[model samples]
Each structure stands twice: as C-alpha cells, then as structure tokens.
Target: MAFLEFTRLDERSVIEYVKSVAALSSILKLDDEGDAAEKLTVKEIGDGNLNFVFLVTNSVHSVIMKQSLPYIRCIGESWPLTKDRAYFEAMALEEQGRIAPHHVPQVYHFDPTMSLIAMRYLPPPHIILRKALIAGIQYPLLARHIAHFMANTLFFTSLLFHSTLDHKRQVAKFCGNAALCRHTEQVVFSDPYQISQYNHWTSPYLDPDAEALRHDNLLKLEIAILKSKFSEQAQALIHGDLHTSSVMVTPESTQVIDPEFAFYGPMGYDIGAFLGNLMLAFFAQDGLVDQPDHRKAYKEWILETIEDTWNLFYKNFVALWDEHRNGAGEAYLPAVYNNPEVQLLAQKRYMAELFHDSLGFGAAKMIRRIVGVAHVEDFESITDAAKRASCERKALNLAKMLLKDRAKFEGIAQIVSAIRQF
Candidate 1:
C-alpha cells in the first residue's frame, strides 16, 4: 500500500507512484463501488526551471501527483532545490482552503516524508489563464472574481481574521522557509537588475533596450518603495504567488492552484502578483494584435480591466473590513478602521507600491522565463520571433517604467496614463 519511495524515484517510478495514489483513493472510497480500477497514465505538464509534475489519469478518475527533487531535473544537478517545498506547499494549501475553498484545488493526500502530494484533478474543465490570454480571448468576469478572491482570502486570513497574537504565531511558523523567501526576494528585488552572470534573456527574442532598462536606478528605487511596504502589508497569510499561470480558468470557471510558494507575506504581494501578470498580458497584446486597430482595442480593454479590478478590490475590501471589524471589540479596531484619511493614505501608498512591485516582479517573471531558465507558455506559444520579441519588449518596458517611477505613480489613473504613453 506504500507509494513510490522518494529516495529512489525516476520517470518510470512516477508511474508506480500514480498507481499507489489511485489505489489509496480507492481505499478511501473516492470512486464508485467495486468498479475495476483503470491503470493510471502519467504525463508531464509543468512549466518552470524546477520540479516535475505528473498528471495521473484513468478511465473513471484522475489525480495529480507532484514530486519535488533535490535539484532541477531538467537542468541536471547544477541547480539545487529543497524537496521540503512540498511540505510547505501542502501546509499552505490546507490553510488557504479553510479561508477560500473554491479558489484553490482540494488536496486529498500529502506526504511530507516523501515530499509528494496528490489532489483532485481539474481536467479539461480548466485551462491555465496564461494560455487563454495568448489566444486573445478575454474573461470579462475574471477581474471581479479574482479581486474578490484576494480580498476575502487575504483579509480574513491575516490579523483581520484572528487576533494580533494568533496571526503572529502563524507567521512565525511559515517563516521557517527562509530559503524560499530568500529566493523570491533575490529574484524579485535583487538579481535581475544587476549584471550578474546568472542574468541573460533568451537570444534573438530579447529587446536590447528592455535589458538595459533593468539597470536603471529609478526602477531600483521603485522596488525599494515596494520592499518598504512589505512589513505594513504583511497583515495576511497570502498565497505568496498568485499570477496568471497559477490561476486556472474557463469561460465560466476560475480556480487557483499552486500555493506551494505560499507564505505569510504582504497582502499586496498576492494582489501585486495577480495584477502584475495582467499587466504582462496587457503589454504583450501588441505582439498578439497583428494589426494596429486590433492592438488598440485589446489594449483598451486590458487597461480598463486593470482600473476596474482595483476599484472592485477596494470596494469589496473596505466592505469586508467594515462588516467584520465594525463593533468587534479589539484593541486595534478603532485605530485600524475609524480613520478614513489615514486608511486612504495607507491604501494609496500600498497601491502605488503594489503597482511598482507588480511591474518589477512581472518583469522578473517574464525575463526569467525567457532568459534565466524558466519560460512561460504564453510567450513560448508565439511561434514568430518578431511577434514574440515585440510582446516581451512591451511587457519589459512597462515593468521597467513602473519599477522606476513607482513612488511617483499615485493611482491606477496615473499608472494607466503612463503605460499608454509607452
């Protein structure tokens, strides 16, 4: 009944693991009674410089079995990764599910000892949102759903959910992943901008101007503004990485997965990551538009959604805060909610920094996929070189400018204005 041993797993071993997971599900009565179980087929379906993913499917049932290796398997043994990431991811999923059940996938089983996890398979039901965007189809309701998702999950899971002391305890526990945090911190805040040997964009498809833009001191200063707000905004147990790829969507459904990078980070980190990818998609539209009119139309919708999403988020967030905190006896109640001026200022400041961080991290995410090692399906799907480079450059420029002028950009209006000017 034991699954594949982590210490001795290869690609074929993945098949054995799938069989075991399927068997375990059967024992738990997950499927129909006494039906002959179908042999599980495992296929690789992940996009990143790290980790291996196996989608285990049989005739009547399907599940995902993800295993963490000691190093990047695709890159050989040169790049190291801690298998313990599975443990962190599983734990994050457990907590997030409590606050936002529909937003994340359900985890049926997990083994910390093996650094592996099995969960409900969301098959043809959902496609990665990143892929959907590259095809130029817009999810008119996505901005509202995601904004509400973030507002509810983030507000309730933070100090706002529990008392200050309880929230602090939760934060301290996740902080054990100092190594993971360091990786994100360096990737988002440090390395990409510097001329490190590790930094390089994919050839021919990279914009020389975009590459040089990362080195601008103004952009670095903008990132600093975001880094500064990290503490104040650390009021929640965030998904830590809520980008487009992390979100699964169809025309009528949206479900987010991969809280493996989840942690007690700033609420804005979640917001920024989600919105940042939209900005990435927005700028990449030009490359998708083959025609000027098409580009203008698509770009307008993207920009307008950005504005609407923020408004929806704030309107939803304030209502949640008021609903939960109004008359609730807590030491920090009046101070946190009563002062509109201060709250508005804090929110304004936070939004500005969120814009900057979104840009910086979006740039890092885009660049890393193209150059460093990991690449995204959105850009990779573009078969034409000129088209791909055009999309990447547009994204990279916005990223650089947002990071450079983060402090000066007050709200969505200014940010949108600046983006249009570019």
Candidate 2:
C-alpha cells in the first residue's frame, strides 16, 4: 500500500485521486472478485468556506468525503490556502470523536497526504438544526443534548481528562495551528465587518438599506466582539467554529461536524458560537412557527434549552473538576481543598466568566448573520421581508443587550429576561 502525501494530487481528477489515495482499495470490502472496485459516487453538499464536502456512496455503504483545499474553492485564484489545514482537521476530528464519540461522525480513514477524510454518512432526516429552524421545526431535546455535548467534550478534552502537563502539551500542539485561527479571526470576524469596497451585501436578504446599516454600525460592534473573543485566550483546544450549520440533527439526535478550524483558543468561543446560533433561531421563530400556540411552545423550549444547557454544563464541569481536583491545584484555587465557601467563590467566578463570554459571543453571532456575508439558514428561507426584519430586530436587540452588560448579567434567568425585552 502506498503511503499518501496530500499535496501531490491535482484537483482536476479529485474522485479518482480520492479512491487511490485512501486505504479503501485494501481495507474497504469490494466483493465479487472482478467488479472493478466500485468507484465512490461523489457530489458536493455543503456551503462551507474552507473545504469541499462530497456525499460519497458505494453499493454497500454511504459516507461523506471531506477535502480541505489549500485555499477556499469558491475564491479560487484570489487567495492561496495551505494544504496543511487537512492535516490539522484530520487530527481535530479524530480527537473530537474520542472525546464525544456518540455526537460526532466515525472517521473511517484519513489520508493526510491527499488532504481528504472519509467518515460515516449520517442521513437526511437529520438536517442542520439551523435549516430545521428555518422550516419552523423544533427539536425538544436539542438543549439537553447540546449542553451535555459541550460540557463533556470541552471539559474532558481540557484539564479534566489529562494532567496539567499533558493538557499543556495538547494545547501546545494545537497552538501551532495559529495561522488557521488567525485566518478565522480575520475572515469570519474581522474582514466581514470592515468598511471596505471589497465587502458588499446581496439580494432580497441583503439589500442596500441593510448593507449601509451594517457597514455604518453593525460591523464595528461585530469586530469589537471578535477582538474580545480572540483576546480572552483561555487557550484551550477549541472546535473554533461551532454553529448550527456545523451541527446535524434529527428529532432525537444531534451531531456536530467540521472542525477544520480547531485550535487552542478561549473556551467561550465554542459556547458563544453554539448559543449565538440558538438565539438566532429563537428570534426567527416568527417565520418558523406556523401556529400561535406552537410559537409560544417552541419559544419556551429555546429559553429552557438556554437555561438547561448552562445548568447541565455547570454540573458536568464541576463533576470533572472534582475528579481532577488534584491536578487543578493552585491553577484555580487555594490549598484549602474542601472549604465550601472557597469552592463556592471559585464556582461563582468561573460561571461569571462563562456568562460574560456566552453573552458577548452570542450577540456577535446573531448580528453577523444579518450583516455578514455568511448568513444563517434560519431566516434564509423566509420570503417575507417585513416578518424577517422584525425577527432580526428582536435578535439584534438581544445581542445589543448582551454585549453591553455581559459581565453584569448573572445567569440564564437574567439573560432570558434581556432576550425577552426584544
């Protein structure tokens, strides 16, 4: 078997390259002795910026083949991308699978040389939660599932699962990925908001009126949010980009995907990203919920999910801290070891940081969907401008409130109260 080198293959015949590059020829079962080893049927499926995702199906099974190109495919010659990104993504996904096996796709094979990944194909009934929200659908268990997912995945992957030295080693390895994270900080946060000729909004969704408003005001706010998020540097390994589109789901299941941007960064970035998208969905409920009662019910679910997610995350995080108490020594607490008041004070400080970050990132995420180039699917399908605008306004109001008073805001109760004002 040939050991693949990801950069050698040209993009012209990607499918043939994928088949030859992966371990499929030897590891995947292709029977009947002479059937010409069934070629992978591939088609593009996502609107992501950094990679090319194909739905690959063979006779026996279905899978997704995700390729990380040196530069974004859509941008073509305008910008050059580093093929090394494929290497980082493969590593990130593999680690995430280990951390949250049930909530992520199974990595069938990774061809670092070819810059491609082969993974289990989850089905359609499981759409991106953002798209589902656009259709006005609700997943009653989303908050619980996501909260657990965040708590378990983030906590264990950091200080809890490994010794301080071990965790530091992991964080250091990922920190080498600074280039990719810098790009994200620029593209998703910085560049999108800058007042420049290069940035412009489009169509029934991004009209001149909205574009000017975003350029004049919204961009500054988003940029500030991005700067603060990047500055926090709690420097733990993070998914880096966690939003509705990054997640796949059905009524009973939720799966998060696309960790190509994975790197060590502020912990709040991940939490804020997920919560921000959920808040966006809540505001867009006007277009999503068909019946009045259903709207109210779904709204409650969103709020409950927010509160429940925070609570569940706190509980699980504390459980991890208890198990790793010896390792957590001095980095976070005094030597008292069992003082209730000391523990409570530490808990208050940690939750306070979480609350602040969540609020800031949440605000940034909601506003960017309206003003940035990469919009959310929650309101993409809504044809009514008046209704959509109203929903967006509500989301914007929540974002403003959160950003202005994130540090002062205490719990889910206060955050929900602020969101309700919108």
Candidate 3:
C-alpha cells in the first residue's frame, strides 16, 4: 500500500492499518479471506508518557507497534515536542542491534512518515524490570547481560573501535536527535536543581531537601561539569534512557527497549542510569520490607548485581580494548603505545576516567529521580509519605555525596559499601 497521511491509530483503526500492510498482517498470522479484526486483537499497552503502543496479535504471533505523537503525551500540547524522536529511535535500535543483537529487539518495520515502529513483541514473564524489582524478583543474569550489551555497543561505537572518520560520521547520524538530548538536559541535568513547575517531591517532608539542592553551590558546580560532558562529549552511542524500566526481563532472558531518548552521548550516562535505578530500588527496599511477604534478600541481590555489573563491565570493556588495541581505533594507536606496559598504563587511566564518569553521572541520575518531574515506582509505591521521604532522603544524600566526591572512589566496591552506608 502507499504511504497514508499520519494518523493517530486506535484499537479499531490499528487493525485496518495492519491489514493494509501485508508484512504486518503476516506477522500476526491474519488470514486475508476473513475480517482481520475477527482474528487480530489490538490492545493499547503503552504505559509510558510519549507514544501510543499497541499489542497487535493473533492467537499465534504478536507485534508491538509504537507511534509517536507530535507533542508530549504526558504534558499535552503546551509542552510541544517533535515526533522525529521515533526516527532517531529507529536508527539507534538498528545500530545497537547490529552491535549487540542478543540484547536488542529486531526492528521488523519502521515508518518515518507515520513516526511508527513495529517489532517483535516481548511477551509475558518479561515484565518491566522495575516492576520486577519492586516485587522483589531477582534477575540473576541481569548484570552479565547488561554488561555485555553496554560494553559491546559503547566500545564498538567509540574511537576505541572506529576510525575518527567513522566515529564522526556515526556521531553526525545521531546529531539530529538533539531534541531528546535537550529534554534529558533539562530534566536530568537542570530541572531538579532549580524551581520548576515540573519538579515535585514528597512535599513537606522533602521540602527542605528540595530547597537545599537549589542552594548548594558545591553540588551545582559538580553538576555543571556532568552537564557539560552530557552536552559536549559524544563518547559513544548510548541508550539515553537506560534505567531499569527501559528493560524487560525474566529470570533467563533480558531485552532492552525504548531508545527514543537514544543519542550519541557519554557512555557513562547509560551505565549510570541503570546502576542508579538499582540504587534507588535498594534504598526503597526498607520501605517495601514492611509487607509480611517481602524479602530482604532482594537487597542483597541488588548489591551483588551492582558490584557484578561494574566489575564485569570493566573486565569486558578492558578485554575489548585489548582485543582491538591493534585495530583502527583512534583513541590509542598500537604503534605509539607500542609496549604492553604502556598499553596497560593507558588502559588504567582511560578506565579510571570512565569509572568516575559513571559515578558522577549515576549520582546525577539518582538525585533527579527523587526530586525531578519523574518519580520512580519504587519510591512512589510506598504508602506512607514519611516513609517514602525517608527512603528518598537517604538516596538523595548518597547521591549528593557521591556527585561531589566521585573522583575519590577508585572502584565499584567502595560505591557498594557507600550504598550500605546510606
């Protein structure tokens, strides 16, 4: 069929739209002779604030179709946003899948005009990792899988693996995604630090805490540096919103989704986002344990996962850098740093920078979630306001100290020990 004008598809219209496209029709196993709607079911499953997501399925197979709206769906037309984010998401998904196929969903279809993407549906038992964490479920393999995904994607995209020309070209491809980057800049980097209508907290309880963040000159200074890195450093192709909620998982399988915020930014942004959310879940565990059935063992799992993720990521990342030490990477030329001793020294310096970067970025991410426009379900699910505030305050204080003292930490173990302190 020819490209139709952009339409906001509903459950009913979505069926007709799918039937018109044969590939989508076949994905759902719809028979052409019968009414497509009779066999195909379209359920709106989008819980996020931006897109319209439909689970189009027959009894046999399913596909998730995501359509972008022209404005922010959560904030309405007053907060106008371009639908072009879907284009960047599609591009990012394709690149990320090429780099790490096992962790990313295959993009079966994308419609630039319609600002839509249809891809393999991640079915039941693959609930949002955040929800699983909130329920005290442990993904024993999460740290390993996430480490692989981040290491491969970030390494392959950076100058450590690509030529300067290729790296710049790849960066150019994603520069159009500046709008989403700007949104991240405002929410994660700027909004929480100042008085904004969008910013909120467990008020009265955190009223002083919220005010303190705005007035803290030292905190503001550190955030300025992180913000500069976010704005100016095109370290790698990062999954810009790589928090726990962006992941869907089971005990055995993990899949990363929703890269609409994807851009060429600091690699630490992705690492920090994931580790920071896990930290948030850890802090919220105290509030959650009030339930008779809740397990405190889950906190132990989170700590181990945090430690394992960074250690494994460090090991995997250094291994990649070593394997490609003689490759076309512009970051460290094998000829100039010809000796193994020098190579080892260079690797240490580089990894140290990345480690500190992740710490600062992670702290920034944690702080914003507590006081920014968006609040995580982990803290929000706590019924008591004072209890919720208590959890958030601990997380907030940890974040403040870490952001200021991120350079002092030499390894992930110290960070884990600090989480215990909080």
lDDT to native, each model: 0.68, 0.70, 0.90
List, residue by residue over 108-188, the lDDT tens digit for candidate 1.
888777888777777775888887877776778878878778887777766655777777788887777666766666666
Give the candidate number with the greatest TM-score: 3
**What lDDT tens digits, residue by residue, belong to model 2 across residues 1-422?**
24345553333344565456435543434443654355546677757766777775556566677777677665665667776787777788888888778888988787766777888789979887777766667787777777777876777666545666777778777766767777666655665455543343334544654544445564466457657667556446678789888888898898988887787676777888888888888887777655546688777777777788777777877887776766643445346636877877876787678768767776766666775656666776666777777677677656766766677876778887777777
After TM-score superposition, the amount by which residue 297's alpha carbon in candidate 1 deviates from its true location, in angstroms, is 3.9
Q: What is the lDDT of residue 27 in candidate 1?
A: 36
Off by over 4 Å in 3: 1-3, 31-37, 291-294
Taking the tens digit of each residue's C-alpha lDDT, what string does model 3 give over 1-422? 35478887898877788877778877766764555447788899998878889998876678999999888887888987889999998998899899999888899889888899988898898999999998889888999999999999999999999899999999999999898999989999999999999999998999999999999999999999999999999989999999998999988888999999887889899999999999999999889777623656788899999999999999999999988888999988877999989988998998899999998999999999999988899999998999999999999999999999999999999999988897
Candidate number that wins on TM-score, 2 or 3: 3
Candidate numbers, best lDDT first, in rank order: 3, 2, 1
Name the weakest run of 10 consecutive residues (lDDT summed) in model 1: 27-36
Residue 178 of model 1 has an lDDT of 60
TM-score of 2: 0.86
- What global local distance difference test value does model 1 have? 0.68
Off by over 4 Å in 2: 1-15, 18-22, 31-36, 74-76, 160-162, 198-232, 288-294, 327-330, 333-338
The full ranking of all candidates by TM-score, starting with the best, is 3, 2, 1
